[model samples]
Target: MLQKRICIIDDDPIYKLITKKLIQKTKLYSETIEFNNGNEAIIYFEATSDLPDILLLDIEMPEMDGWEFLDEFCKLEKRINKESTVYIASSSIAIEDKLKAKEYKCVKEFLSKPINLDKLQKIAEQN
Candidate 1:
């Protein structure tokens, strides 16, 4: 079984499918859990005993956006452990958004759409 568990929070079904396939291709993560929105993801985290090793978050969604999630996530003292990490996976090109993400300590990087093998490799190497 794959050892690493990764969580993806995004609204687009097509994007989630493609991302899951790409991550599987890398053989990096053992488990991939997806949420259509940040609220759902938060609920999962609250209910589960173990959190994913990494979180791929999107800035836009119907229920809860990335920014709102991060704000609420930070307040969840029991949610994240030091072993876990978060990344902003967004199609947004706005410099302000990127800068805003950097403000979050758990966020490692801001990734643009069409995340490639090279980027995935780099993310894998971070841990």
Candidate 2:
């Protein structure tokens, strides 16, 4: 199987750290790229057209929040980009958050914090 790429965008280092560790344990991807916030990830994607196979984004960030990132990202030349699997990982349980996440077509699903292997496997399948 071809190794998949997964990007993690979160301001929390612990989330990024644990997620990366979990991903490594899965041995499911060639690499897992991480960003402390959404703007950094957006900047990365803008410079590099080779987008990840999947994206794990957090809703809240200091700059370029997840919603903004999604809005700006989808507007980019859709032809030049492949459909990167998106999973919104957040601690927010607000119904509004879930509803807002679905507004973006790129988002495949939303998972609450403390992501586990099961969620990772499911996201892998979605990829």
Candidate 3:
């Protein structure tokens, strides 16, 4: 089995910590990258040639939200690896937010917050 790299883009430190622990339990990813907001992740993406295999994104964040990040990411699509999949991991239960996520081609799925071990394992397997 090939080990994958996962990136988490969110403002919540607690969520990031908990998710990282859950990711460890899955034992599927060799590397995990974290960003406090979409802007930070965008900067990293712009500066680096390497990209994570999977991205877990949050909708609401300081300085560049998920929607804005998606727009910027689309512009970099031609330069970046197409294999990288993005998943919206937000706490929002709004139907509008979910619908908005579907507009982005890079978004694979919209997952609720507090992503469990099983979901992480399933996401890794799918990728």
Candidate 4:
């Protein structure tokens, strides 16, 4: 299996912990990084030369929401790695949110929250 670096950008610590555990269980990622919000992730992206191969983002956050992150990411897209894949992993079931996600070309998929191990495995396989 190809071991990739995965980044989880969510405000909920519990969610982050659980997701991290699940990601580890998949055994497909070399490293897992967590960010409290989109802003922190953006800062990391700006500073780090080693960017994540996969990004799991939450729509609702304190510092900067997922949508805001997408916007900022778009601006920094040129500087960042084009191979990086972004997935919007939010609890939101709103159709509007899903539609909004489609507007961003960087987003590979809009996944519902509480992503299971199977989903993680599939994501890893696809990428």
Candidate 5:
């Protein structure tokens, strides 16, 4: 079976590290890509055909936030992989944030910060 590809877009290094480790422990993805900011992630997505099976996006970042990234992502002419799924991973508990996330068709779920193994496992199983 071909392994899944996962991408983590966040400004927090420690969060990225821990998330990556947890995902790896699940053996869900064959490879994982990390981006410091949404701008960098957008650049990579625009320039390459290698889209991930799942994208874990953070709402707060220096360059571009998750909302901004989603806007840019919507503008892309090329379609994202049909199997690709995006999940918003953030610390925001604001109701507005959750509602906004729901507006995006590509977004599958809104995960709280410090994603746990159970959530990862469930996501992995679903895919």
Candidate 6:
């Protein structure tokens, strides 16, 4: 598989650290950019040279929530591949959150927190 760009946006430091390490292990991404909150991620995405091939975003965050980030991000066409660039990784098991994420076509899928290596590999395979 080709190595692609990956970005992870989450407020939890531990989660971000662990997941970033796991993501690196996959050797699937040419580079990995991380943000502590949705707003920062959104800002970077807006100004970045190219959209990450894969984006791992948390559902909830301070400043800008994932939904709000999506709203802003959707307006930027260069930030993703149609319907398959971003994935939601959250601790929430709320059906509503998962269902709501589906409203955004760029959201590849929703995966629960403490991201598993298998899941990341699977995401790479899918998108």
Task: Choose the strongest candidate by lDDT.
Answer: 3
Candidate 6 residues 1-127, lDDT tens each? 7887888888899998998899889888788889888789767766753567888889789899888888877877544543328889999999999999999978878888878899888887876
Using TM-score, rank the candidates from best to worst. Answer: 3, 4, 2, 5, 1, 6
Best by TM-score: 3
| lDDT (tens digit, per residue) of candidate 1 on 1-127 | 3357888899999999998988898898788999999999888877774678888899999989999998878766344554468889999999999999999988889999877877776777776
- lDDT for residue 127 in candidate 2, whole number 0-100: 69
| List of clashing residue pairs for candidate 3 | none
**TM-score of decoy 3:** 0.96
RMSD of each: 2.0, 1.2, 0.9, 1.1, 1.6, 2.0
Clashing pairs in 4: none
Model 4 poorest ten-residue lDDT run: 75-84
Q: How does candidate 2 fare on TM-score?
A: 0.94
- Tell me model 3's lDDT, rounded to 2 decimals: 0.93
The C-alpha TM-scores of every prediction are 0.91, 0.94, 0.96, 0.95, 0.92, 0.90
Clashes of each: 0, 0, 0, 0, 0, 0
Poorly placed runs, candidate 4 (over 4 Å): none
lDDT (Cα, tens digit) per residue for candidate 5, span 1-127: 5678899999999999999999899887899999999999889988885678889999999989899998877665247544468899999999999999999887899999889999988887777
| Backbone clashes in model 6, listed as residue pairs | none
Q: What is the lDDT of residue 6 in candidate 1?
A: 85
Which one wins by TM-score: 1 or 4?
Answer: 4
Model 2 lDDT tens row, 80-124? 557787889999999999999888998989889989987887777
